[model samples]
Target: MKKIAVVAANGRVANKVITEAVSRGFDVTGFGRKENNTKAQHYVQKDLFDLTSEDLKGFDAVVDAFGAWTEETLPQHSTSLKHLCDILSGTDTRLLIVGGAGSLYVNKEHTATVMEGPDFPDAFKPLASAMGKALGELRERKDVKWTYISPAGDFQADGERTGKYLLGGEELTLNDRGESVISYADYAIAMVDEIEKGNHIQQRISVVRA
Candidate 1:
C-alpha cells in the first residue's frame, strides 16, 4: 500500500482526509500539535517547524492541512511549505496543500481574484491572503512536486459526503444557487483521489459539489 502522512491531522478537514485515505486502504500516518483520535498506523505530535528531513522521508506523500488565522501562525503557512520543500527536494514524495479559495478567479475571464471582490468578508481576508501567499511560495519552488487544492468559497464543515464533486481550474465554481460551496467530506474524497491518480502535478485545482 502507498504510505501517506497528514500534517495538522487534528483539524476537521484533515480528519476527513485521514478517514477517506484509510477507507481506501492506504498506509497512513498523522502529525499534529497534539494526538488526535485517528485510525492511522502512526501519529506524531510535534511542532511543524521542528520537523526534519529525516522525519518525513518515510512517506510517499505529505498532505499539508496545517491551518492558522492568527498573526503569529499565519506566516508559518509559507515557511512550513518552504521548510518541507527544502527537505523533500530531490525526493519522489509529493506535497498536497489544502489551499484557500481566495486566489481563485471570480470571473471566467480571470481578471480578478475572489479576494479582490466586494462580497468577500473582511474577517476572512487575512487567512485567505495568507493561503494565497503560501501558494505563491509553492509556485516559485522548482525542486518539489506540489499540488494545491482550493475548495469553494463556502466550504462547509457540516457538509455531507456523497462521494461526488466537480473539479475546476483557477476559476470559482458555483452551484445552481449561485453560491460557491463544498463539503469537507467531499473535499477529502477529491484529495485522496488526486493522491492515488496524481493527475494534477505542480498545479492548483479546485473542487465543488456536483
Candidate 2:
C-alpha cells in the first residue's frame, strides 16, 4: 500500500482528506499540533514548524493540509514550507499542498479577487496574500514534485460531495450558478487522486463542482 504523510491534519478539510485517502486503501499518517480522534491508520502529534522530513521518511507523499498563512506568520510559514520541500527534494516522495484560491485567475485577464470585494474579510487578506506568494515560490522550484490545489471562490463547510468537479490550470472555475464552490470531501478526493497518480507536477490547479 502507498504510505502518505499528512501535515497539519487537524482541520475539517484535512480530516476529510485523511478519511478519503484511507478509504482508498492508502496508509495515511497524520501530523498536527493536537491529536484528533480520527481512525486514520497512524497519527503523529507534532507542530509543522518543528517537524522535518526525516520525521516523515518512508512516506510516498506528503499532504500539506496545514493551511499556514497569516501576515504576521508569513516569514515562518514560507521558511517552513521551503524547508520541508528541500528536505524531500530528489526523493520519490511528492508534496501535495492544499492552497488558497486567491492565487488563481478569475478571467483570462483578471486576477482572483479574494480581498477586493466588500464582503471580503479583513482578517483573511493577509493569509490569502501570503498563500499567493507561497504558490509563486513553489511554482519556481524544479527539484520538488509538488502540486498546488486551490478550491473555488465559494468554498464552504457544508457542501456535499456529489463526486463531480471541474478542473482548471491557474484559472478560477465557476459552477452553473456562475459561482465557484467545492465540498471538503471532493477537494480531498482531487488531492488524493493527484497524489496517487503523480499528476499536475509543479503546477497550480483549481477545482469546483461541475
Candidate 2 local lDDT, 1-210, one digit each (tens): 999988888888888889899999999999889966665788988888788768878998998876655456666556767877888888878898888876677567755455555667877778777877777788778998888899987777778988878887777777788878888888888888888788788888888888
Runs in model 2 deviating more than 4 A are 69-71, 109-121
TM-score of each: 0.96, 0.90
lDDT of 1 by residue, 1-210 (tens): 999999888999999999999999999999888866777778998877788888899788999998888988899889888988888898899999999999998777887999989998999899888888889889988888899999998999999888888899889988667768899999999999999999888999999998
- Give the Å shift of residue 106 in candidate 2: 2.2
Give the lowest summed-lDDT range of ten residues in model 2.
110-119
- Give the candidate number with the greatest lDDT: 1
| Root-mean-square deviation per candidate | 1.2, 2.1
